[model samples]
Target chain A: MTIDWNAFTPWSALAGGALIGLASALLLLANGRIAGISGILGGLLARQAGETSWRLAFTVGLLAIPSLWLLFAQLPPIHIEAGYPVLVAAGLLVGIGTRYGSGCTSGHGVCGLSRLSPRSLVATLCFMGAGFATVFAVRHLLGA
Target chain B: MNKTTITAFAAGLVFGLGLLLSGMANPEKVLAFLDLAGNWDPSLALVMAGAIAVGLPVFTWAKGRQKSLLDEPLKIPTSNDIDRPLVVGSLLFGAGWGLAGFCPGPAVVATGAGELKAVVFTLAMLVGMTAFQALQRQPQPA
Candidate 1:
């Protein structure tokens, strides 16, 4: 397969990855919590008392930060190749799958792997393998 | 807000910024990375490596601590059993990710950016999660 040399941004990717690592680390050190997005958001739906505040605060911060960044740097252009129906289907799968799996890229891929959790490794491999397979199927076989 | 809340908020901000800078928020970029057959972009691999590099040391240090800085009991997941749900669920999540190139974190962040598609996707995801919770609460046929 050909590599997209023009679109590649290794430095930015590395820098951003470092920031994510720092964020998860800080959360663990200070709050004693895993920075798993699904867990954080899911907790809000369950509405457990004493847990609501931190989850809400984190959600607010997540939403607010990017908006604030627009004042300084223009966000890169967004292009979604899927239609509304596809997006909806994909979103549903992600939400339910993350909850059932108990983690996502952040929880399992970032935090779990960092701690060398075997479960996270399996989950990461499963999801990543599935991701690769799906892309291959959709873009190649189905040609969507 | 208390220190705990402030810290959580700060962590979220940093996480969001990381997503933006890493181009994870951009579906095209993510899709390109996922595309193994044509025009593959390995930039995301570097992102993961960078994150793991920093994370390995911190997690090691955290493991030695009994309590967090806020005096809360450290709550790391201790489950080692790889069950069917974990594998099936992850497979589904990955397929969805490949289909749309948007995961939970990026979708939520995209919604905040007021992308109409993101808003729709977020709503659908919440509905999906709610459905899962609802179904999970239902009695199983014996």
Candidate 2:
């Protein structure tokens, strides 16, 4: 197996990852909340009074990123390999799946692993395995 | 906004920026990492490790606390079950992630950037989420 040297970015990845960790840590320390994007979004739909405002604010802050980032530099490139059909199907699966599973990459992968929750570990393994298999099937078998 | 609200906003901003800086916002980078059988990019591994390294200690400390520094209830997840829902749901989520490299975080970030593709994906994701909400309210078949 060949490593994609040109695509590999260790420093930025680590630094960015640390920033994500800091965000999660900050949320926990200050608001007593987990920085799970799916959970945050899901909570928005439930419409619980006294809970809606903070969740809305957090979402607004996320929406504010592009404007904020554009102030200093150009926004990063976002390459989408999938077409609309795939995107729609994928989006549906992701939404339903994360909610049903109770977490996603951020929840299960980053925060859950950090806390060393065995359940998160199991969730992580299942998702990662499925992801690897899906990619293999798509790239190698379907030849997409 | 209260202290909690402000901090949550700040945290979201930081998280969004981290996705941008760490290459997580870039679907190509994520796809490259996921493309295991191909020329694999191992950078995402370091990303996960770096996040966990910083997060582990903070979580461990938070676990012992009942209240946050801002006087809010510490809301760490308490569920320990590794059940059918978790496995099935995660597998479905993983397949979707593999099909399209956009996860919720980066998709929202990109949608904020006015990317049309992200717009489509996010809308569909919301619809799917709404469907889940509807399905959840249904009477269970015995």
Question: Against the true structure, whose DockQ is highest?
Answer: 2
Kindly list the per-residue Cα lDDT of model 1 for residues A1-144, writing each as its tens digit.
999899999999999999999999998999999989988988888888888888888888788877889999998666778899999999999989998999999999999999999999999999999999999999999987
Over B21-137, each residue of candidate 1 has an lDDT whose tens digit, in order, gives 999888988999999998899999888888899999999899888899899779899899999999999999999899999988888888888899988888887887888878888
Q: Worst ten-residue run, lDDT, model 1 chain A?
A: A73-82
Measured with C-alpha atoms, the lDDT of residue B76 in candidate 2 is: 92
Candidate achieving the largest lDDT: 1
- Candidate 1 — which residues are off by over 4 angstroms? B140-142
**Candidate 2: regions farther than 4 A off:** none
The 10-residue segment with the lowest total lDDT in model 2 chain A: A46-55
Candidate 1 clashing pairs?
none
Error of 1 at B77 (Å): 0.3
lDDT of 2: 0.89
- Per-residue lDDT, model 1, residue B30, is 90
